[model samples]
Target: MSETILLVGHGSRAANGNREIEQFVQSWRERQPAWRIEVCFIEFAEPLLDAGLTRAAQDARRVIVVPLILNAAGHAKMEIPAHIAAARLRHPATEFVYARHLGAVEPVLHILERTLRRAMLALDAPDPKTTGVILLGRGSSDRVANGEVAKMARWLHEETSHELVDIAFTGITHPRLETVVQRHSRIGMTQVVVLPYYLFTGTLIERIQRQIAHLRQQYPLLRFGLGGHFGFEEEIFGLLDERVRAARADGTARAEHMMECDGCKYRGLAEPHESHHHDHAHTHAREVPA
Candidate 1:
C-alpha cells in the first residue's frame, strides 16, 4: 500500500498563507505522482487535521504529518499531539506518525540566505562586508526553540561577512525587533534589512512591517526593507519528502500495521471495537462498539 504524507501547517487567516502551502503541495505532487500528498491546517483553516486524516486513510495505510511550524512550541507540542490522538481514536487501525517541525534545518538556512541576497540585490545594498542583516523570527516560550533560532543567527553571521547580524523576535521573548533595529542603527550601519525567517505573512509579518516603518521615521538616514517569506521553495519540498520517507521507514506507517486488543470481548469477532484506558493505567479498560 502507498503511504500518505500530510503537510500540516499553522494555518493563517491570510489567504496568501494557505495559497503558498497549497502551491508547495502541488509542486510536491508533481514530483511523486504515486504517493499521496495532502495539506492540512492546525487551526484557523479548512480541511483540518481530522478531515485530512480521514481523506488520507481512504487509500493509505500510513499517514505521516510534517508540521511546517518553525519550532516545537504550543502548537507543535500540545495542540498537534492532541489532534493526532483524537484522529487515532477515530481511526485506530490506521498508522500515524508525527515528524518534527522544520527546526533550524540546513535547507531553511539556505532559503534565508538566498532571500537575503536577493533583497540586497534589489535595493543595491552594499556587500555583506559593509551591510548588516537582521534575522527575525517569531519568538517562542520554549527555551530550546528560541535557542534554535539563535543558532541559526550565529551560523548566518559566521557564514557571511555582514558587519552586523543579530536575531530578534516579533513576540514571546527578548531582543525584540525594535530593540535589534535600534542597536544596529547606533553603530552607523548605512543599510539594515530585516529578513523574516517565516514561511508565510501573518500578524507577525504585519507587526514587523509596522516596526520597520517606525524605525524608518526614527532613523531617516537608514535604509530598510522586508524580504519575502519562504514560499514554494523546492528545497522545502525535498526536505519534506525525506521526512515522509523516514516516517514510513520508522515503523510508523499506518495502514500496514494493525493493533489488536487481545483482552477485548470482541477480540474473537470480526467487528471493530474501541478501547479506552485511563491515565496510562493498563489494567483499567472500557470497550465500545465501533
Candidate 2:
C-alpha cells in the first residue's frame, strides 16, 4: 500500500527560517527514498497542514502526520489534533496517525546536553562548576508547556554539575531571555552558556542573537557562548522513525513519550492569562516512507 509521511511545522514569516525547514526535509528524502514525504505548515506559510493532509490522502493509503514541535502546548495538544481530526473526516479511507512531539522523547535530554556542551567547548571548555546555564524555550501562554522547559533545565542541572541552571522564555511567561542572560552574566560565574531548547532556528533565534550581542558588550570578559538548535541530528531521526513505527503499528495518534500527568505542578498551578503568549514556526525533516 502507498504511504506518505506528512511533516508539519509551525510556519514562519522569515524566509530563511522556512528554507531551513525545506533543507531539513531534503535531508530526509536523501536518507530514505522509498517512502513519499510531504511538508506543511500550521500557519504563515504555504501548503498548510490541511493541504498536506489532503495531498497525502490523494496518493497514499496510509498517512502519518508527524508534528516537529518541541513542546506540547496548544499547538501540539489542541490545534494539531483538531486539524488531524477534521482531516480524518475528509479522508476517511486513509489511515491517519499522529506522532508525539520531539520534546516527549527522553533522549532529547542528551540533545540539550550536547547543545550546551558545544557552547561550552567553544568557550575554551569552561569548568562546569563555574559556569552558569540558561536554557531558552519558545515560551507559551500555557503554563504546562512552559513548565516542561523548566523540567528540562532541571534535568540538565542533574546531568551536569552546573551550579546554576535557569529557564527563560523567548516570548511568554516570566524571566525573559534578556533578564536571565543578563542576570546570570552579572553573577559570579566565569561563563554563561545560552542554549535554546528548540527543534530548529527561527525569528526568535535572531531575537536571541540580539540579546547575546548586548550581553557581549556589557560583559566582554565573561565567556558568553550561544548554542545552536537541534538540527538534523541522528538521534532526532531515530526518535521520529521510532514514533512513525509505533504510530503505524497501532494506527492511532500515538502519544509516545508523553509527559507524565502526575507530579506536574503546572496541571493545577495558577497561571497568567493565556492571551499573553504568542506563537511562531519551528520544525524540519525530508523523506520517503520506508
Candidate 3:
C-alpha cells in the first residue's frame, strides 16, 4: 500500500522560516528515499493543511499527518485534528492518521543542552555558578503548553551545570523574554544566555533580537549571549522517523504520546481561574550544536 507522511508546521510570516520547513522536508526525503514525504503549513505559508492533504491523498492509501510542533497547544489539540477530520470526509478512500507532536522529548532536550554548552564555551567558559540561562518559548494561552516549556527548562537545568534556568515566553502568558531578562539583571547574574525553544527562524525571532538589544542597553554591565533554535539535527530525523513508524503501526497517534487533555480548556475542563488570553502574531538563531 502506498503511504505518504505529511509534516505540518505552524507557518511563519518570514519567508526563511517557511523555507526552513521545506528544507527540512527535503533532507528527510534524502534520508528516507523509500517513504513519500510532503510538507505543509497550518497557516501563513503556501500549501496549507488542506491543500497538502489533498495532494497527499492523491496517490496514497494511508496519509499520516505529523505535527512538527514542540508542545500540544491549541493548534495541536484542536486545530490540526479539525483539519484532519475535514480531510477524512473529502478523501474517504485514503486512511488518515494523526500523529503526536514532538514534545520536550529527550533528544530535543539534549539538543538544548548542547546549545547552552556552546554558548557558555563561546563566552570563554563562564563559571556555571554565576551564569543564568533563560529559555524562551512561543508562548500560548494554554497553561499546559507553557508549563511544558517550564518543565523542559527544569529538565535542561538538571542536564546542564547552569546555576539558574529560567523560563519565559516570547509573547503571551507571564514572564516574557524582557521580564525574565530584567529579573536576571536585577539579581546580578554575571553571564546570561537566551535560548529560544523554536524549530526555525521567523518574525518572533526578529522581535526577540530587538528585545535583546533593548535589554543590553538597559543592563550594559551584564554579559548576555543568545543561543540558536533547534534546527535540522540528525536526531530530528530520528524523531520524525519514530513518529512515522508509530503511525504506520497503529494507524493513529499512540495514546501514550498524545497530549494529556484532561485539563485542556478547550475540553471544558478549564480551571476556575482559566480565562482566554489575547492572541498575537507568530514568530526563531545560532549554528545549532551538531
- For candidate 2, lDDT tens digit of each residue in 1-290? 88999888887777777788889888888877886878998877889878888997897788888887777666765566667767879988988777766664578888888888888889889799889999888877666667788888999999998999999877756788778767776778888899877776677777788888988887887778898888677878777777677777766633422434443323433235432111112221111110
TM-score of 2: 0.85
Candidate 1 lDDT over residue span 77-173, tens digit each: 5556567777778888887787756667788888888888888888786766656788887776656666778888888887777868888877768
Clashing pairs in 3: 202-284, 204-283
Give me the candidate number with maximum lDDT: 3
- In model 1, which range of ten residues has the least summed lDDT? 281-290
Over 1-290, each residue of candidate 3 has an lDDT whose tens digit, in order, gives: 99989999888888888998899999999999998999888888989989999999998998988989887787777667767778889998998888777877899888898889889989999898789899988888777787888888999988877778999887757787777877887877988899999888888888888888988888888888889887697778889899878777876535223565655555543355743221111211011110
**Against the hidden reference, what TM-scores do the models get?**
0.82, 0.85, 0.90
Q: After the best TM-score superposition of candidate 2, give how far the Cα of residue 268 lies from its true spot, in angstroms.
A: 12
Task: Report, for every candidate in turn, its global Cα lDDT versus the true structure.
Answer: 0.70, 0.74, 0.80
With a 3 Å backbone cut-off (N, CA, C), the pairs that clash in candidate 2 are: 10-281, 25-285, 25-286, 28-286, 29-286, 29-287, 35-288, 35-289, 36-289
Order of quality (lDDT)? 3, 2, 1
lDDT of 1 at 169: 79
Better of 1 and 3 by lDDT: 3
TM-score winner: 3
Give the runs in model 1 whose Cα sits over 4 Å from its true position: 253-290
Native-to-model Cα distance after best TM-score fit, residue 39 in candidate 3, in Å: 0.8
